[model samples]
Target: MVAGEKIETREERIPLWKLKLDPTNVRFSHLPGPLSDKELEDEIWKENETRDLMKSIQAAKGLIEPPFVMEGDGYYIIKEGNRRVVALRKLKEAVDNGEIDDFPASYFDKIPCEIIPKKIDPIRMDIMLAVWHVSGKKEWDALNKASHIFKMHRDKGLTYDIIAEYIGVSKSTIKRALLAYEECQRFLKKYPNDPVGIKRFTYFDEFFKKSYLVQKATVDRSFRDKFMEWLAAGKFRTHRDVRVLPDILEDTDATKELEKGTIEDALNTLYRKYPDRGDPLWETIASAVEVLRSMPRSEVKAILEDQAKRHLFSNLVSEVDTLKAELNRIRNGRSSKLK
Candidate 1:
């Protein structure tokens, strides 16, 4: 990794774990999503870290995983790390593009670090971004926050699964929250029009982003009164399930059919047979149907193969050889009878 050492191209198949680090050629993925805002905000710490990193680079001259590069010549931002990379880029771009009129005192020391071309390694970068969002601390907090509200409503005689999705969390999480909400009756109230209000609350993104306690105290207070009134009337307590009307114009025909209960008996029978296959299952099946509807005849086999692999249902995949063998066996039995 020294100045005399060779730099390898992307095509080189060095095991990802084996990269040597050098100050000159050391690589790190600079995607925005991976960096937390706090890490990016600290200028002094970053400078010291960079300086120490360079010293290490001069000593070990080893390559770590080649820095993750994004598009063009800049580091690709996945989420949290964008600030750091962006800070570096802003300085570099200003200096290199001659955009700077009055260079700051720190500019001289920082400009060299900013020289990294902002290039995104698309494939790995995308996977990393998805991984961070799902597995990151921030997303977990958001999910937990949404789940708290969802459960609270459920304990006050609301159905949780449907309510959960409106707030952006899984049904199971909503179920867990209901247990806690039930015990927090001292803090909660009931309302007559609370369901409608709760429905409206879905549009309030600000409420969902905060901690559960903050949300319950500040945002839900007005609605809590309505919930208590509604409880006295027993409207929510008696309600079996909530049904939302479809907003799409194309769905008018289906909606009418559903309202008339022409399909009700059949729908009930289907549900009884497969109780676990709810709306979620229908959503998946509908998506699959849409894919099949758009597929061309020539691509059907390829599509089937892809589906089989994804579903792990390769046993259901039929090849021409199996069909031919079945046909041959039938033909041979007929020929022997004829003879």
Candidate 2:
């Protein structure tokens, strides 16, 4: 035959012994035989498809050069073309058992192939192959696939590392992106109509844990839709606009002081003296009150005295439970006299 010329009239039947499995070929053949009846594979077994597969095996008059060969002997090992080998084995067994005496001889033909034996590490193949697949993908594409896997893992309530390993990315990246996603979710929920894009999300884990606003923003549709719409409008030009409030909001003491009008009243006085003490002073007074609350009650009097000496006459440092009780007593006495 001329070089590169196709061979005309090749023999249809390949001697079962001469055919060999090739690892270099990536193509797989349809297995004709009944697949190994493992319990695990029962889901794939459809009785209705059996007749179709059988008909294909019988009616396929054209010669097919299979990519790999099945080893006839000891402990079945498929080197390559696992599907084809399985199919051929099934057909041969059925034919020999007189299940179908008359069938196409060409079904077992020598499929033109170059055999390269596969050397697999049985113990680590699944893990290693999974890793290779993950690593080989593009970063953005990997992120997409990772996101899906991460969602599945989360649905199953698994960790980021397990999902990362399953999808083949570093656990740290998964964690970071997840944090970003969660934070973005919070911001999006808070200002759903707000035009704060994902680029502006700042993940603050502690803040999220404490903020009812943050949780509400993430879950409440009224808040979330407005924030997203506003964000989409390009209202927040920088990440600062999307910045998370400080963690002091979660402080039990700070919350109580706010309720008691200490922090808010002090801030109003500060605003009367210096007009720019809006958010900054609110934060300061809240933090200072939190610090005071964090302290022991035994030390509160001394702390209050020291702070008073420093001219820090915020409502928080000045008010005492004793003084509040005394005022209540005075009010009650006045009401009795009026009666």
Candidate 3:
């Protein structure tokens, strides 16, 4: 229900041969070239939870909810429930090939479908799919969601706010999806026919979360290329490693290490060059100093007037002095070694 659009629909039992799998299904949109019905079925089968849906259908012996389809020239294109259709097709295939025949072949002959008008506005179709998958009960995976959002914004010329309102997400969420999707497109363009760019899209999504990293990559083309190369090479072992990219890029030696090594090597170089950046004790001491510097004068006076508080303060000062003496001795030893 996109605002004022009224869609006319009817229910019917459509034969499996008359139902065409949509090649432009959001789940497999990243795939290159036109896919045949069998190819589409195979691709949909590869999606997460498709196997589970097949199991559920096998247990139930029929679909719980009918698939929604739009009438095409001589066929009906599956809109919603692509996975369910794929599942049914697979089950039928299993039975047809004599692989396993528990149920009758008549079960997969004709499927119940909610048929919509073929001439329904394409935008309405997009909105309906978004409602069913993006913000609805049967949600698409993150990469699939991003692909749909990117299509709405980039191809359809919809605003972020408009898409957010329809998808039940914030404008910022839409923006992040766009960024991640665009990065994935960039990767795809550089390495055509490689599904890894879309498969490992969360790595790019994590990379775009840090504003500093995004800005750096935007301003420096070489950095951007190297980062994409690292992404393709699987240099980032996990998405969490993408979070440390800003620190790695900030240090010259660490950045060079990352160019030739893994994120672990870059992080080790960064920490070794800047020990205080990685030291928990240094952070604790710095936090303590900031707290004391910002302490209220009245609180400090009260502490001085109370005997118990004064004793605690004296102990704190003694501990600080001891730490300072230890640090000074280490610095002196290092200086002596240098001399």
Best by lDDT: 3
Using TM-score as the measure, name the better of candidate 2 and candidate 3.
3
Task: After superposing candidate 3 on the true structure, give the runs of residues whose Cα lies further than 4 Å from its correct spot.
Answer: 96-102, 193-195, 218-222, 232-234, 271-339
Candidate 2 Cα misplacement greater than 4 A, ranges = 1-161, 164-214, 217-219, 244-339
Candidate topping TM-score: 3
Q: How many collisions per candidate?
A: 46, 30, 0
- Candidate 1: where are CA atoms >4 Å away? 1-48, 71-124, 130-215, 218-339
Error of 3 at 71 (Å): 1.5
What is the C-alpha lDDT profile of model 2 across 1-339, one tens digit per residue?
111222232223345435433331112111234333332123222333533444565567322434322333432233333334435545665766778667654444434432322343322322232343345431223333334333444544656665565555677666655654565656655655543333334323332333465576667747545444444555434434333222223445543433354444433444454443457766676677677669776665664568663454455346756678899999999999999
lDDT of 1 at 124: 30
Q: On a 0 to 1 TM-score scale, where does candidate 1 land against the true structure?
A: 0.20
Ranking by TM-score: 3, 2, 1
Candidate scoring better on TM-score of 1 and 3? 3
Computed on alpha carbons, the lDDT of every model, listed in order, comes to 0.37, 0.44, 0.85
